[model samples]
Target chain A: MNIVKLGYKNIADRPLSTLLSLLLLTLGVGMIALLLQVNRHIQQQMENNIRGVDMVVGAKGSPLQLILSAVYHIDAPTGNISLHEAEQLRKNRLVAAGIPLSYGDSYKGYRIVGTDHQYPELYKAPVSNGRLWQEPFEVTIGATIAQNLGLQIGDTFMGTHGMGEGSEIHDEHPYQVVGILGYANAVIDQLILTATESVWEVHHHEEEKSENHPGEENHAHEEADEKHSETTAHDGTPGEEREITAMLIRFRSPMAMIQLPRMVNENTNMQAAVPAYEINRLFNLLGVGVDTLSTIALVIMAVSGLSVFISLYNALKDQQYEMALMRTYGATRWQLVWLVLQEGLLLAGLGFLLGILFSRVGLLLISGLMEARYHYSFSGGEIIREEWQLLVASLVIGLLASLLPAVRAFKINISKTLAYD
Target chain B: MLITRSLTFSYDHRATFQFPDISLEAGTDLLILGKSGIGKTTLLHLMAGLLSPGTGHVELMGTELQTLSPAKLDRFRGRHIGLVFQRPHFIRSLSLQENLALVQYLAGKRQDKARSQQVLESLDITHKRYDRPHLLSQGEQQRATIAMAVLNNPQLILADEPTSSLDDTNCLNVASLLKQQAATTGAQLVVITHDHRLKAHFQNSILL
Candidate 1:
């Protein structure tokens, strides 16, 4: 008796074709939905990673690499800048805070970030257990690193010579885990933090005992060791004179951000990288592929619309006699037209529901892998506002697709149809 | 009541068929006997407001069907007319009850579930009420179509070779059902057919 019941019956009458068409439509919409979700997550992750840092100053190199290494824990540093140069930049009246980074070693695959105590404080990272690294050979593991490696605060692990595993180990200077950071939903939760001198000392010890250079090796190693020891002892700190990979710069005003990068480039060898600008450039490069994928999804959606039209038109042809009989039995042309339009609208509604469900499940599966591999967090279970707009858009397309076929039903020659029957 | 004046129609430009002015009151059963291709179905179509007459006026229940707009014509036909074809034609996707319900809805009539049930029972198709037309037997499908026709209680009932597919027993049963429904609804019944076997069932006859 209800119109929706009639619509359902019509679809059930040809189960195979209806199912195939529904699946096609669902796939098209699903891809678009997934793309939208991923795009949103990428932008969100970029913004989250760049949240606190106002600017990045490092050795003159790729601005994108500088931001990547400083803001996000990806890519190697541009190069190291001297501590005296960094101190000079920090002396500027516009500078509010500066956290230095010295990274050259890795534990397993996770980066071992050597920096001052200001690093965790600047990033607002709190130690969930134990304490910050206070000794040269003591390190604080990130939440993810601790969880993955099953390492406790007292556990000790040797750093690798390179970023990847299977590299030669700096066996003489194994570091002990002193603390683990809480989950911060940022890059800090996926790295190991240590003192600046620890990383330099690990490589310095390797250079001292190398067998290939017996003559100058001892002299160079002795001089390096003396200076290193002297610096560590003079400052009453483990490693004050060691080089750092980059510095996270926070300014007092927007004018400082505009003025500081130029000063760093001209007055010092360090490069000033703007996080927002680098991230925007990265997105701009990635936008072309996303736009192409979106275009493909849209094309598939249009094809599904056409498929709806063809299905309705074919159904009309096959049901002409039935239409005529209905006409004879007091069913009007408008009623028949309504019946066809209702079917199209129902397909749209069902397809959109399935699409959104697919998007969420797909994002959930990808979220785990992306977070593990790239340390980027995407909220998989959340439904955003834009998905609702996609559902409505698809439904409108379905309605429009059915309009022509419904009109054809209205204009059928009832007399001829009855005679033929 | 049904009235037609100077009814004329043509399929192509070469040939035309004409009918003299005729009138029939309610509760009358009129048989239209004609050979093949003689515009019998065309006349029924015009009477049912499914087609426009080339040069004529068809008045059903005091309203000129030819003069009404297309939309009003559709509504008028749905409310005032019931049509039965020789071959059973049904919306295959819909069950019998739903098909009947669609007629009631289109006619803008109060849904009479009891009346639809009664029609199905009278046609001996009550057991097939929930089955789609494709699932029903040929005679059962025909009977279901007849049940749908009478669901709206229309004033004019038109049949275009309604018994062509029936055996003698079924033909007689279908004819009696048509007559019984027409009498019950106070409708003027017009049967258009080339089948001569149906001649004895009606008292009034128009030979074309």
Candidate 2:
């Protein structure tokens, strides 16, 4: 019989032990697969958001928190900077383009971003239908928000006061959904964008009427007066005149990243955060656990290798007489060793298949949860190249595991074994 | 021809066997009768090149079995020696025909389907050639092992208790078949057993 056939026979003879070993190997490999795919997906999402913004400027606080809240729409914003201070930074000759973001409002769980028309232009996100938000109380929804809320171009919705659900709603001034942005696989596709004036209108509608007295009503009714009347009435209004959540700054030169953030912190109350630095810091913090997990996996694989050796050793001990009989019938010791190692290869190969199967099933379940709660999309597809490497590595380790038992088989005393009975 | 000279073996530092000289020519059937643990199986193993004698030399056809390396000894044994164990030790996973084919392949002999079938037919196990050893009866498994042993047509046939578990009729049949096949191949046949019922079948006898 060929070596492969012999290996197959050995595995078939001990079906339960073979299956248990394979299941253990699959657990280690499957975990590595899931971690690798999720890490890749997160990195892709981060890079997409960091493309247009060269620097982030927010009120003095943790730089990492500022970047997380600004770029990924995850954490809460650090406190706001003054509007006059932001306008000064925008006017600098080194600055190329700046887009301001006003927050503190949301619809359902999705953040309602109050920014200019340049906000969508900054992300290069095109409106899938209708026009951009131009009038007060007009809004443009993201693709996911539109789909989930079943809101079309003409549908109107009320904005809430805070970021999460159960926040107080501004039922007095309802907003109309005038447009929907196409999917960009970024944060823009998961937020609601409108004019900055719309945010001021919702919060300062009561303050506007209180300042218009009986004699000043005729002046407020004038065309030019009506435009400046709201600004004059709430001149100290924190909601209307206060700074925004964060500013996205792009420099004309890449060297501005190094020279500009230091200049901003030294010259103003705002702090600048570099996306790359914070991302690396985040990975370093997370990488320790990932590395520890990988080390544990390697150790488990080594144990599994020893398991293969011990099991094969026992099997050879039990089959001594049979081995001697084969030897007498012209079988070489090297051929016998090959037969044992072949079993190891078969076990590893089958275990790898099971590992890949479990990874896909795991990814599918995770994707369902992410889509339902966070509205994030995940695709089920072929195994990536890195996952394939894990499989090949497992096989190599298995082959190494079988080496000791194979050597023992080669050194067996055929004559003594035959003569013992 | 098989020859041994001053062959000595020990167990636990105590000498168990000392054969000064013995030679068996081709086509001779020798029945070895000994008590249990008398080194009968050991002597057969020495003649079959399965064990090395510490004190002296054993030669089969012209090559000294003691002078060869372990690897060369294994190859020599596979091509020149045929051994039947006390109980048939067939590889349980393989069919009877595959068992025979593996013996031929390991001996570097071309697979001869006609010869394999003929051996099976002689043992009346031709119908069970495709069955695993576990599916066969004790006598049938023993016959299959015997068929595999003779598949390569070795220079010497060594049987260790060939009829230990068989009925009287089957024992006589197995003994006659071993002698007939050895005579046909012009090979020396050595039967090592404590069973005295097998003594009358062979002309030459050694009592230990």
lDDT of 2 by residue, A286-403 (tens): 9998889878877766666666666677777777777777777766788778877888888888877887887778888887787666656566457889988988888896788788
Residues A1-421 of candidate 1 have per-residue lDDT tens digits of 6556777888788777677667768888898999989988888767877876888988787899888877887776666777777878888999988887877567887888888887777657899999999989889988878887899978898987546576556688889998999977678888899987787677666654654577755553343212121111122333355566788888888899778988888878789989998999999999999999989988888888888778877887888877766666566678888888988988888888888888788888888888767766576556678888888888898799889988888888888877775
Clashes of each: 0, 0
Q: On residues B1-208, what C-alpha lDDT tens digit does candidate 2 reach at each position?
A: 8888989887667656876477888888788889987788778877877777778889889999888876677788888888887788887777888878777777887878888898888879999988987688887887877787777788888999999888899899889888877876787898999999998898998887
lDDT of 1 at A96: 88
Per candidate, native contacts kept equal 0.66, 0.69
The DockQ scores of all candidates, in the order shown, are 0.54, 0.54
Question: In model 1, which runs have C-alpha deviations exceeding 4 angstroms?
Answer: A104-108, A116-183, A194-241, A257-259, A380-385, B10-16, B54-56, B62-69, B110-112, B183-186
Residue B49, candidate 2: alpha-carbon lDDT = 72
Q: Highest lDDT among the candidates is held by which one?
A: 1
Candidate 2: DockQ? 0.54
